[model samples]
Target: MKKIGIYISGLGQSVHQESIEKYAMRIKNELSYNDTGIQYDIKSEKIFYTQDRESTVVSIFKSKNDSEQELVYKLYDFQYHEILTTKFKTKNLLVKNLILFGLIIKKLPQIFLRIFASGGFDRPYLTFYAFTLLLLISLAIIFLIPVSIETASQLNFSVTIPEDIRSILENVKSYINHFLPISCIFAKIKEWLVPVTTFILLVIPESKTLITSLATEFACVDKYIGNGEQSQLILGNLDLLIEYIAENEPDSKIHYHCYSFGTIIAMDLLFPIGNIPSTNVRNRSALLITIGTPHEFINAYYPRFYNNRSPIMEASLTWFNVYSVADALATNFRKDMNRGPAEFGIKDVLLLPENINYEITSDKKMNIFNFFSMNSIRMHKCYWDTSPNGQSCIRLLFQKMKQQDFI
Candidate 1:
C-alpha cells in the first residue's frame, strides 16, 4: 500500500524544498534500517495550485535487493508561514495599550494557571526572572545615589571661592534642599513604576526583539482562535490537498505530521468529521501525529475556541499525540472536560522518561536553576535531534509507528 505523509511546520520554522528533501531522506534512512529492512529512494516535486500557494511532495520508492522500485511513501511539506506577516494595525497607541491591558486583566486567571500548570519553571519564571533582575539593578542604582552624593560633598578643596560664585552655590544648595523631598518621592515612584512602564513599552510595535517574537506568536494564535483568515486558508488548503490525493491515489494511506502550532491547525482541520473530504474519496486510511504541541496552552487561555463542542471523530483517522514534560511548551493533551475539550479519540504518549536524568553538559550539574534554564527550550526541539536522548525518543516514536504500520 502507498503511504503519504503531510508535514506541517510550526511558528518561525518554514520548510523549503531543500529542507523537505532532507527531511524525507532522513525518514527514508530511518525506515531502511534493520527495523524495517526496506531500501528506499525519494523523488521530490513541487505542486502549485490556487492562490499561488505551493507544496512539495517527496515520493519515496522502496525495493528489496534488486527488485523493481515501487512507490511506498509520499511526504508533502505544507507551509503557511506567510500568516506571520499579517499586520495588526494599532493607530491609537493609548487605546491599543488599554485594550491589551484589559484583555490581560480578564485573562489573568488563565495566565496564572498556565504558569503553574505542570512541567519545569523555565517558561513560568522567565518573566519573573527578568523582573527580579531589573529590580536588583534599580536597587543598586538607588543605593549608589546617596553614597555618590556624600562622596562628592566630602571632597576637601583648599581653594577659596569668589563671593559671586559662593552666593550662586548657596542659592543652588537652598534650591536642592527645598526640592529634595519631592525629588526623592518622585524617584521612589519611578523605581516602582519602571516595570509597568516597560510592559507598556513592549506593547509598542517597535519594541524589543523578544516582544516582537511574542507579538508574532500571539498574532498567529489569534488567527487560529476563531474562524480567522489564516485558519480558513490553512484548513482550506489541507482539505483540497487531501481530496486531491485521495482522488489521484485511491490506495494511498495519508498521514499528518504536525509540530508545535501546526498541531492546532491540524486539529482545526481534522477534529470534525464534516470538515474532512466527502465520502466519494477512495482512500480511507488517515493518521495524525502531533509533536511538541501547545494544545494545553491554547485550551487553557482560549477555552471558548476549542471547547464549544465535542469533536466528531473521523472513523478512518487516528490521532497520536507525543510530548514531554521537559518541553516547556509541550504537554500531554489533557482530556479534562472542564479545562479543555474532551479528547476521547486521541491517544497521548509521553516521549521521554522524566525520572532519568539527561545530562546536557559535563560541567553544568542538574539543579533547579539549570533544569529550568535553557534546557527546556532545547527539549522542545528534541523530537528530531539525533543525540542519544533524542535517539531514544525517536526509537520509541518509530515503535509506535511500527505498531500502526506507518513506516
Candidate 2:
C-alpha cells in the first residue's frame, strides 16, 4: 500500500509543515470518523535527537489496510531553489531576468506538453499548439533584431484612430466642456488624482514588482528543467529521503500532492528533463494529485497565438486533477465545438465537458473580495481551503482519495 506523501510547491512557497498538516489533518479526521483513516503520522521536527539534520518526512505506519504495514513519506519542496533566487535577486536583476526569459523561451510550452502528453491529443487545433514555443521565439527574434536602414528611415506613415475611439475622445472632450465648473475643480486636484489612480492600479491584484517577481520565479523552474542546473536537487533530496526510510521503516510508495504552480513542478517530474524520473527512486511514486493546477489554463490560452512543437506527460498509474469551478487557474474545464446548419455551411463552437477521467470536483462559493476586479484571483489560491461557509475542498479530496474509483 502507498504510504509516503510528497508535497511539490509552486512559486513563492517554502514548506510549512503546520499548514500542510492542517490540510492532511482535515482529511484524516474525516476519514478516521468513517473508519478509513490511512494512519499516517505527520512530522516536521527531527526524530533523531543526536543528529543535527532533522527529518522533514511524515511517517505513515501500521496501516489499517495493510495489516501493520509501515512506511515513510517526505515533504519534498523545490521552492528552496526559488528561495535562493529571491535571496540574491536584488544583487543582479538583469542576469536574473535574462536567465528567466531564456528559460521561458525554452520551456514555457511544458504546460501544454503536460496536457497533450497525458491525453487530449484528439482535440481540435492540436497541431497548432504543437508549435507554440517556436512561434513565440520567432516573434521574439523579430522584435529584437535591429531594423534595416530602409525600414528604419522615417516613413510617411500617419497613425489613424478608429471612428469609435475618435468618437469616444470627442465625447469626453464635450463632457468636460459642458461641465466646465466641475472640470475646473478637477484640474485643481489632477496632480493628486494621477498618483492616487496609479497607486490604485498598481495595488489591484498585486504590485508591479510582486507580479514581476512571481514571473521571474516561475521562469526559474523552467530554466532548472531546461538547463539541468543543479540537476540532482530533487533527486538528491529524494535519495536522502529513501535512505532515511530504508533505515527507519518498511518501504512505501510516495504520493505527491501539488498545488498551483507546484503542478508545473509535478509536470517536470512526470515528464522530467533529468535522466532520473520519479520511478528511478527506491520507493517509486504511486500517485500525483494536483489542486488549483494551471495546466488546463495554459492550454486554453496557448491556441489563440504563438506558433510549433507543443509538448505533453503520459500517465502509467493514477493522476487526480482536482479543481474548483471558481478557480481561475483551472480554466480548461470544457471544449467548444459547434456546427451550424448543413445548408448554411458554417459552424458555431459552444461548450463541451472535458473528456478525460479522474478529474475530481469541489464546490466553490462566491467570494466578496472578487467583486472589485480580480474575481478569478481568490479562487486560484483557496481551493484547498474552506469556502464561504465551511465547504472544505481538502476534506472532499480526502473522501475521494479513499474511494476505489479514484484510486
Question: Judged by TM-score, which candidate is best?
Answer: 1
Taking all chains together, each candidate's TM-score versus the true structure is: 0.63, 0.52
Candidate 1: C-alpha lDDT = 0.55
RMSD of each: 10.6, 14.2
lDDT of 2 by residue, 138-178 (tens): 33323222121112222333755566755655565556557
lDDT minimum window of 10 residues, candidate 2: 340-349
lDDT of 1 at 370: 41
Model 1: lowest-lDDT 10 consecutive positions: 349-358
Please estimate how well model 2 matches the true structure, expressed as its whole-model Cα lDDT. Answer: 0.44
Where does model 1 exceed 4 Å of error? Answer: 13-18, 35-38, 63-67, 88-106, 113-211, 273-285, 334-374, 386-393
What lDDT score goes with residue 27 in model 1? 65
Candidate 1: clashing residue pairs, number: 0
Backbone clashes in each candidate structure, one number apiece? 0, 14
lDDT of all predictions, in order shown? Answer: 0.55, 0.44
